[model samples]
Target: MSPTMTEQIVLTAREARDVPHGEKGKFYERASERLGISTATLRRGIRSAAPSKERRRRSDSGRYALSREEALLISATILHAQTRDGKRIKTLKDAVRMLREKGAILAARIDKDTGEILGDLSDGAIARAMRGYHAHPDQILAPDPVTELRSNHPNHVWQVDASVCRLWYLEDGLQAIKRDAHYKNKPKNLERADRFKVTRYVVTDHYSGWVYARYVRGAESGENLCAVLIDAMQNRGDRDILRGVPEILMMDKGSANTAGMTKNLCQALDIRVFPHEKGNPRANGQVENGNNLVETTFESDLRFYTVRDLSHLNKLARMWRIRFNAERLHSRHGRTRSMAWLDIRQEELTNAPSAAACRNLATSTTVKRIVSSVLRVRLGGREYDVSQVPGVLVKGPLDVAYDAWGDEHIKVVRTGKDGRPVHYMAPLAKRGAGGFFEGAALIGEEYKRKKDTPAQTARAEIEEMITGERTKRGAEKARKEKRLPFGGTIDPFRGMSEKDARPYQVPTGRDHPAIAPTVESPRLTPTRLAMLLRDRLGRDWPEDGYQRIVARYPDGAPEESIPEVMAAVTGKKATPDLRVVKA
Candidate 1:
């Protein structure tokens, strides 16, 4: 035991004066007793009153032993060895063992009594080092220096996620649980759970902190998530103006964040997706904070509302979302969500995709599949005919970008002579395996499907002779007989003529197939200018390079026309053929 503060103070005074305190034995002993110390302790305390040297910590000494570089490597390995939920799958011992296996000799401490050595890289030491280094992520693993997340502008980025509601509601099956106290009810039936728990899917603008939420009765499912996202993409709420698709979306590694959904959503909306680091909620802090608000601001007052079903819960949630957007002030801008959203210029908010488009994208799935010899490709345990995307399902299996689940439209990524994406024939869904083949593109009169004439009947006979025979024998037999590339669809032409067939078109000149839509400019469109540029710059010039040249003249798109694209493409020697512009 150490001496009391009073004893230490008095002892210090005595030591400074060189007083003979121990000489008065009874007096010192009584003083020591009063101070909760012995006479010997009192004398030692006085002698130690003069400040002694400070003892250093073990970490300070060993800090230099493990170089910062090596410590970071070990720490990074441990960090990355975590699961999606952020649980460490690899232990410190495992990390050390791996380092040793890779010929990295680490420091160790020896047991004084047993003469055994233990590696110095303990879990606690690594954890402490990590905490120190997290303050400076620049020295460690980080996103590319050029790529950084921005949250100052609307549509810059948006974060989405789902969380379990903190409060429970009166579910249908179990009235007994709801009758008890908030903490009371515990049910043991399959139809019921601990009172009730609901999932809340939230979407928030990273810049404005505007939020949209949906409450569901069941677990966090992908279908429900898709529905909520579709709603957010299509509808503008009563008070909130946060409607358009974000330029980039941030999310965690939840099942709903699958590649199928991401690719379709991103492609359809022309947006980008940045999945949050595994188990790192801070990366998606905007929406995560919003989720907490869903619990605190709304769910906290659950007792006030007479909640009936998931619909009622969602109704209440929408009103809460409206209030959160219109009434609540944002910390960053000191403006309400609606104000921040409205502050953005109208031109910045482009066209919002229609509800039909949302449905199509939500159902679309992009899969890398090989087109079979029978002009068919297998996917999701079913084979689909590729007759419409490429008329007659030509031989090779190129990149197929299609959404078959809904409209079942397919677009074969076929390149042109300049090796650029060309709009090929838009093929309809083929029949078989619960499928159907529609018509092809209707860009021009030439693109229109040739009505079945005497020639087509003979051609169909020849097609059946080659495909039907081999298809019956199977794909292997079809492979042997390459005469008919693929078996024709059951209704070959979907049994429809130009008189009443559905309208589908690919807009491009026969000589130069356009990759994307023509720009709105009357004088110069990207597709139109690229054609002229390509003519001047040899046949081998890249299509994108020409497009870039057209884009460089900023006046053309959404502004005055600039013929700089032609001037830049055709050098001084070449004469400018000011071809008349047409849409």
Candidate 2:
């Protein structure tokens, strides 16, 4: 079989590569002439067909000669000089120069024989070293690996985020959509619109991608956040199908989202609040994408329509959200968001409380009240009869919550037999015209007696079992005859004191060996005495004179006897005079 063009080129290139270096041009010319092509084209083809040899590498390849500490120092210096936005203001050369000048880094090379620095350190070397050591600014500032998250069912996890609607603003009770031609680079227009900037709060179900949005005037605040959340959780008719408290709410760690009121509301509804780490917006990327979706699909059309105010904008947002969720097909599920949400089981979906009740839960704390002897508890300036609540006891503490659906009643929470919380609707106690409780018997027209409570019945049974009588008179007679409670069968201190009890032995302490005191010799050295004499006489004394005085004294003279010692040594009355000298 005849060789193909590629194979022929490969054979020619192999022959040319093995030829003598000086005759390479002649070899290429001969090959090109035989192949009936130009020398340049043939040479190119030969070059392309030849497999390149692997380049040689040094033993220390991919390793930095610079120590890790030096590389880290260079990186830190550059990073420290960067701006708040992470723009590097200091170049590698600049960093190297500064560090070299400060004696923070040494020359790149040294002579092994002479022990002298022989090579100058360059910025390129430092940069290469940083890259090799993984201490470069780029490597240090790179984003961390993202963790993929998932949801088990609809409403299992929801993400909420707020963004300013920079394209539109409320002015003169109407929406003013900004145009790039007029407001793109105009600072004055932006400044004016900043006063009426619209903030959009968006929430998305992680599982189904269903979205809910609300627009409000001004910046994000705790009140606005809570209001948006409450509205999103309420059933807004059949058009808007996404409504319920999510099992877990994911949001940015903004002040409004982490506010006490926001946490309290979520807690009241049994929703867990999860705030993403700072500088990690992708942790709640679902809601962020939802924000962009609304901006592009819904708000883009607002310029063609008229919006009266914030309320009108929110109404439009609601309508758009409903249509978007119902019509738009989700890329992941291959179905509309509404349909995907409908796949949730009945038990997995939790119905939200009324708007008024949710608002109360957000703003108010659960009030604790004690039930009165009459089986009534006062809450919100009204008295409610809790006698109908199971396990209700007089003077017992009860948690009271506002009943937004029924103003005439309040909800009471108590522990049930199963150890879970039980809720009850307690009606307002009826009051008579004279401010007295109604249901009392009239003088002659009616006769009525209050029903005995569980506590009252238990008390009567206990009295009958203990005293062998149910009547008050019989109980009193039995108590007098018994003298002591429980028929004198109970002992208050049965095991406290007994005949076998012995007195506790006092612990005796052993005396420790006495330590002799250390006595220090009072004899002063010649140098010390010389210094003291110099200070006392206001003049320096000879070294020999101080030595002679110390020798004569044998035992060191006390500090107070310095004057006498000086007089005895000098053979004259020496009156020591001292004076302070100011510098």
**Number of colliding residue pairs in each model:** 10, 0
Per-residue lDDT tens digits for candidate 1, residues 146-243, read 44356657767888898865556457621223444444333354345433667788999877788888877677666767677777766565465677
- Report lDDT per candidate: 0.62, 0.81
Which candidate should be chosen as best, given lDDT against the real structure?
2
Error of 1 at 284 (Å): 1.7
TM-score (all chains, Cα) for each model: 0.45, 0.59
TM-score attained by model 2 = 0.59
Candidate 1 ranges with C-alpha deviation above 4 Å: 1-148, 173-191, 194-197, 259-262, 365-583
At residue 2, give the lDDT of candidate 1: 38
lDDT of 2 by residue, 26-126 (tens): 88888888888788987777667778677799896886657789889989999999999989999888887888899998737666689787787567877
State, as a TM-score between 0 and 1, how close model 1 is to the true structure.
Answer: 0.45
